[model samples]
Target: MNEFVYHPSGKYLFVATGQGRVEIFKMPELELVRTVAAHSGQSNCVALAVSPDGKRVAVGASDALCFIWSIHETICERNLGRLDYHVRAVAFTYDSQLIATGSEDHCIDIAYVNDGSRVHEIRLEGEVYSAAWHPQQLILALHPRVILVNETVSVYDYLATPVESDLRNKNAHIHCCAYMETFRNDSKYPN
Candidate 1:
């Protein structure tokens, strides 16, 4: 398996394979629910994301495309289409209204989940490897290589302004990141 993620409702597990296949498994029992042939050829599917409501899923492949599927049916309802380079990561906002994708083209694209209309595109200095959304805010965490050298985690707001940057781990490459929900209700972390 290339990547896998559980549904927010804890009822399903989505698995993406290196051969461009996506399989959904039922929770607890782990029964094979459905399978999707996401990409053509032998492209690797490196990213998979389930929407907060557990009604949708996004799959990112080396074909430079992101496909959105409905949990109710085994069909791709929308496609973010082809990009400049292969997609490395994908994420959905907490409200399930937006989908974010990071690509080897050193760019991040934010699009409406319902219509696939791009809302914003953020260009970075290096290739974006991963992206994550804050639990309760519009903040986005991006794991990108700075100037094709340093692995950095950049925190940005909805407007695409860098609010903070952490370069503590010089030797480690952060492949993925997520915000803890423990501080979601705290006043110190404002949306």
Candidate 2:
């Protein structure tokens, strides 16, 4: 398996495999529930994401496509189609209305979850290694060489000015970033 993600409800676990399969397993006992042939050919699934509501999942594959599946039905509901490059990361907004995908093409694509409609796109300076949505805000945190927070998806560098000094000369390459749920209620880590 390349990637696996537990449902927000902790009832199910979704596993993405190199053989283009997405397997669903029950939690705790870890019993097999269902298997979905997510991709075709020799392409492998590299990333998996579950919606906040635990009703949907998004699978990213090396075939340059992202497939969204229903958690209850175990069926592919929507295909994100081919991107400019292979997908490296996938994330769903807190409301489960939008999905954010990062690719090796150095771009992040945001799309509507219900209809697979393109909402917005952001091109970064380097390949996007990871992406995460704020737990209580509309901001999106993207990791390339430096951590960037996209506020409202319109401004690319909304928080850049405040953290410019710390980011300078750091030359850090972040593989992934996640917002702590408890931090949302804390004042110290305001989003």
Candidate 3:
């Protein structure tokens, strides 16, 4: 498997595989639930994300397409189809209203979850390695060489700020980043 993400409800685990498929497993015993043939041409599925609402899963593939599936039905709900290269990162907004797909083409495409209509496109300086949405906010954090926060989807601009002076100066490469859910200041570590 290339990547796996647990459902927000902890009931299911979704895994991306090199064989162009996604395997869904039930928690506890990890019983295999379903296997989805996700991509044509047998292109690998590289990344995936579960929506905060626990109703959807987005899987990114080397075929340059991201497939959004309904959690309950286990069916392809929509396809975010405009990306030009292998998609490496996928994220859903805090409210589950939007999704962001980052690819090797040096861009992040933001689209509406309901209709799969694209809302904005963010052109970055390099191939986007990872992306995450702030757990309680609209901000989006990106990586590899830059840290960008999207102020708002309506604005269509990113605050291109570096996380640290040393990282910026030394050209440190960040492969991934995530915003932990601390809804009530519960803990600093991931659950």
In terms of lDDT, the best-performing candidate is 3
lDDT of 2 by residue, 1-191 (tens): 88899999888888988878888899899999888888875889989999999888899999889999987787899989747778889999888987889888767777778988766666565577678888866677876543344322222453211123443324422222322112133355566
Between prediction 2 and prediction 3, the one with superior TM-score is: 3
- Point to the candidate with the largest TM-score: 1
Count of backbone clashes for each model? Answer: 0, 0, 0
Error of 3 at 74 (Å): 1.6
* C-alpha-based local distance difference test score of model 3: 0.77
Better of 1 and 2 by TM-score: 1
Cα lDDT, model 1, residue 27: 95
Give the per-residue lDDT digits (tens) of candidate 3, residues 1-191.
88899999888888899878899999978999898887774799999999999999999999999999998887899899898889999999888987889988877787779888766667765677688988877678876333234321222236422234323223422222322221222244323
* Candidate 1 lDDT by residue in tens digits, 1-191: 98899988888889998778898899999999887898775888889999888888899999899999887886799999747788888999878987889888867887778888766677666577788887766667877655322223444433443222423223422122332122233355454
Question: Where does candidate 1 clash, by residue pair?
Answer: none
Q: What is the TM-score (0 to 1) of candidate 3?
A: 0.75
What ranges in model 3 sit over 4 Å off?
Answer: 145-191
Alpha-carbon lDDT, every model: 0.75, 0.75, 0.77
Candidate 2, residue 38: Cα displacement in angstroms equals 1.2
TM-score of each: 0.76, 0.74, 0.75
Worst ten-residue run, lDDT, model 1? Answer: 174-183
Clashes of 3: 0
